[model samples]
Target chain A: MSNQKLFHVAVVGATGAVGEQIIRLLETRDFPIEKLTLLSSERSAGTKLTFKGNDITVKAATPDSFKGVDIALFSAGGGVSLELIPHAISHGAVCIDNTSAYRMDPDTPLVVPEVNIDRINEHKGVIANPNCSTIQMVAALKPLYDRYGISRIIVSTYQAVSGAGSRAIDEMLRQSKEILAGNTVEPQILPVGALPVKHQIAFNAIPQIDKFTENGFTYEEMKMINETKKILGDDSLEVTATCVRIPVVYGHSESVYVEMKQDFDLEEVKQLLADAPGIVLQDNPAEQQYPLAADAAGKLETFVGRVRRDLSNPRGLNMWIVSDNLLKGAAWNAVQIAEYIAIEQK
Target chain B: MSNQKLFHVAVVGATGAVGEQIIRLLETRDFPIEKLTLLSSERSAGTKLTFKGNDITVKAATPDSFKGVDIALFSAGGGVSLELIPHAISHGAVCIDNTSAYRMDPDTPLVVPEVNIDRINEHKGVIANPNCSTIQMVAALKPLYDRYGISRIIVSTYQAVSGAGSRAIDEMLRQSKEILAGNTVEPQILPVGALPVKHQIAFNAIPQIDKFTENGFTYEEMKMINETKKILGDDSLEVTATCVRIPVVYGHSESVYVEMKQDFDLEEVKQLLADAPGIVLQDNPAEQQYPLAADAAGKLETFVGRVRRDLSNPRGLNMWIVSDNLLKGAAWNAVQIAEYIAIEQK
Candidate 1:
């Protein structure tokens, strides 16, 4: 490793779920940062943050906030990223965005390092991190796509409330207690927060994740459908997604069924995934071993298990995908891409 | 209408989630039960249960407990059903079982009333209630199955922990409090009870519902696959299931992708579901309408929404199915089958 001097980094929306993850990941991964900046909305600004034993002050993210910053990581919201990310880029700083605003743009190199690290060099000012559901999926699918030529993917996500934001997580907890106490609690954070309608999430499974499209798929569903195709670089591959928010906190688990163009034995598929980057294989059945959200939370790797061939379809395979949504799905993935970009820039 | 008097009813496992729903259903629907029998395991026996201001004693279920029992509904377990159902059947009582011991048996009729209520008459001794996930699926698919014969089905479930039993629900609550308090607590009841392993169901998801079959599907998953065909009276429809446990306590949701044997218009399919038995449609998109677990919990109807066509195949349709697992998925469905059998026997 070349001893290149480190660059200073700032993370906007520093107190949110994904933002807090970016902070923990920076310390654990030993990201080479000479200094760190913590920024949030005005309400959260001025809060003191402890990072690597040093307290850092958080400031409001404004247009003039990125003069000396070399790189800015964003996960606040689509609106915040839309307003502040370009301003950060225009101020001589490269941005890695973890929102949908820039992901579909042809110019932005939407990246998952394990899937396509080389695409980092193609960044056009702003790099996009694909949806959390898409990132884990394509990471798990890429090795198989390269080896078996995946022609189709059908994914149904069991998502966590933390994915909606910090308040959504709080709503789930508050409502759980209220439900057990035999009190009625109103929901305020799910099925599109701005829609003026709230549904209780306690002891419930809601099929709608984001606002609906005229075609009937929710925005979260469409993001996974389109982002997977864009990241895998296979426009012809069929992708269908159903995104649902369950009463989970950290990890998002998906049941993925894929039909490969080339047929392969189940052992071969397991072996290939076992050797893939950023993937952990926990497929031993004798021990009742498999991936679980409790074990996967706070971890960066995508866990794949319960892998098998579809009983009725000759070319189909079924598997379970689990990853900590806050970490790998959002903050960790954004940071991982930044690391790859930093190494190449060096 | 003839003046035939309706028989008395008994709800086994009356103190549990399903039992509560069964009680409410019998009262609300005004099913003509001359007497209501409330039975439970010996540990919970002797408690006084009040229904519509009438008090009843919770009796311990034993092999000889079926004497003079008109209809005994069993939601206790497969072990309890296996032991007591034969005795109930021999004593001129119709047994409606809500466990897996007899679902796939050749002589037993696995009934989802919307699909094949006629199958109830075919029950030789015990009538099996289809798995909760399977129940919602076939209910939504029955209309589509009749109009356009279904060739295949791929389903991924976002299941509630209450599907496991009451102890799992308690574990979820206890663990959530422990997590919110920032403490470490060992998990005791999730995924499966017989397995020594445990997982935190609070803010998490477990992919393996039951023990894995040699074919890679969990026993819960296999239940969905096998029971769907049997309940629909056709073993030829290709079906696959992936069962997952989320933090939700009451309702089970499914993302079902169906390939119709014949062509289907999206609106026609939605209309068919609207007219189908026991299904409630909430598919208006401009107003942001759809099914939610919070809305369906404690309600007996199966909720269907998010009806749309698949992006890649004109013959394929994707829909979301939601229902309170304790009600339609477990307790009420069993009671309804018992009601059907009582009517058919007369």
Candidate 2:
């Protein structure tokens, strides 16, 4: 560890939910860091965060914040990433963005390290992390995709409040308490859209995650559809998604139905998933063992279970995938990319 | 109303979650009942319930409980139905069962009043109500099936805890309070199965609903599959389901993917649903209006929204369906069948 090459790292949106996880991952993984810089919006600029038993005060992020920084991780929002990514690139720093800004940009690579790490080398400056729901799904299915080719996917998500941000989490908790206390709740932060309407997230399921697109799908659903194809490098693959938000605090659970190109054995399919990288198989029907969001919270690995052959279509398979939305879906994925870059540079 | 002939009615499991809803519907809808008899297990036998402002004492359900019953409604567990339904039949009572025991029985007619009311006459003695999750999906899709022949269906459910029973609802509420207080919870009554494994349903999603069948699907999933085919009266229709238990208290939401035998116009599809019986169309993406479980709670109508054509298959459509599992899914559906019987007899 002492002989490794040390690089300077900068974390934008350091006070945000995903950004906090990124800092924690970096500290726990013992990443070779010569120096660390924390950057947030001016509203949160003066906040001090502790890392490795030392205090580092956050500064307001600007185009000039990337100077001398070897790698810059961004999760503030799409607006911040779109405005500052070019400056970060011109300063000779590779950017790992955790927003929708550069994800579908043709030049930028959308990479889930387990699914498409090779594409990380093709990035001009930014490697975009797929949506939190998409990351766990593709990571769990990549092994199956390799074993037997996949032609189509239909997915329905039970997503958590944390994917929307920390405020959404607080809203769910507060609303839940309010409902439990027999009071009417005023929803303020869910189904985050341009409209004034908000739905209660406590004891409810909100079908809309982001604003509706022209095609009648929410931005979150379209992200899962478009980003899955991009990360898998298969534009011809068919994908449809319905993303719904539940009251869970951290993990996102997905019900995935995939139509394979060839007929496969169910036991072999289970074994392939069990052997996959970054995927833990928890499917034991006799024992009633399956993935639950509460169990997957704070974990880095994606959990897959409830594997069964579709009774209607011979080539179709059904399974459940779960993961900590902020961990594998955002922070750990970005950190894995940074680790790959560190190894390549060394 | 004074000229109508009234019949003696009995309600098994009168104190249950679904049974309570049934009694409320009976009172609100002004059903022509000459006498209302409330029956329960030996444990809750003496519970007092008021119907039409008359106090009725609950009696322990037994083989002789239906001796003079002209119409009997059963919402107790399947064990009670399987054991006592035949006795009700021998005593000449036409039973409307909300349990799965007689749903697939060839002699019994599984009736959803809006979908297959005509089949009610074929019942030997019992008319079976479909599973709660299955009831809502089929209700929403029946209009579409009539307009465009449905070839296949794939559904993923976000079900409420009350579907299990009143005890499960209490467990969820208690668990949520414990979690809010930052204490660990010991789950005792969720994922109700033969095995002893229980999952935390507060702020979590459980993939298993009932016990797993030999085919790797839960009994709840199989109930949705087999019951849909039987109710639709089409043995060739293909169906698949993934039933999940969420933290909600009342309504169940479904994400359904259906492929039709004929091509469909999206606007025409919306019009058909809006005009259908017992279905309310809440689908206006421009106004961010879609079906939500929280909003659907206590409502008897099945709410449909988020209708869109599949990106890959021209004949395929995706929709979101929500309904109060106790009302439209169970109690209201059973009552609709009883109403039809009363009208037929009159």
**Best TM-score goes to which candidate?**
2
True-vs-predicted CA distance for residue B251, candidate 2, Å = 0.3
Candidate 1 on B41-145: residue-level lDDT in tens?
999999898888899999998877788877888888889888888889888787888889899899998888878887777778678888899998898899899
List where candidate 1 sits over 4 angstroms from the true fold.
A1-3, A79-91, B6-24, B34-63, B67-70
Model 2 DockQ (Cα-based): 0.87
Query: Top model by DockQ, which number?
Result: 2
Model 1 — TM-score against the truth? 0.93
lDDT of 1 by residue, A102-127 (tens): 99999989899998877887876789
By summed lDDT, the worst window of 10 consecutive residues in model 2 chain B runs over B190-199
Which residue segments of model 2 deviate by more than 4 Å?
none
DockQ of predicted candidate 1: 0.64
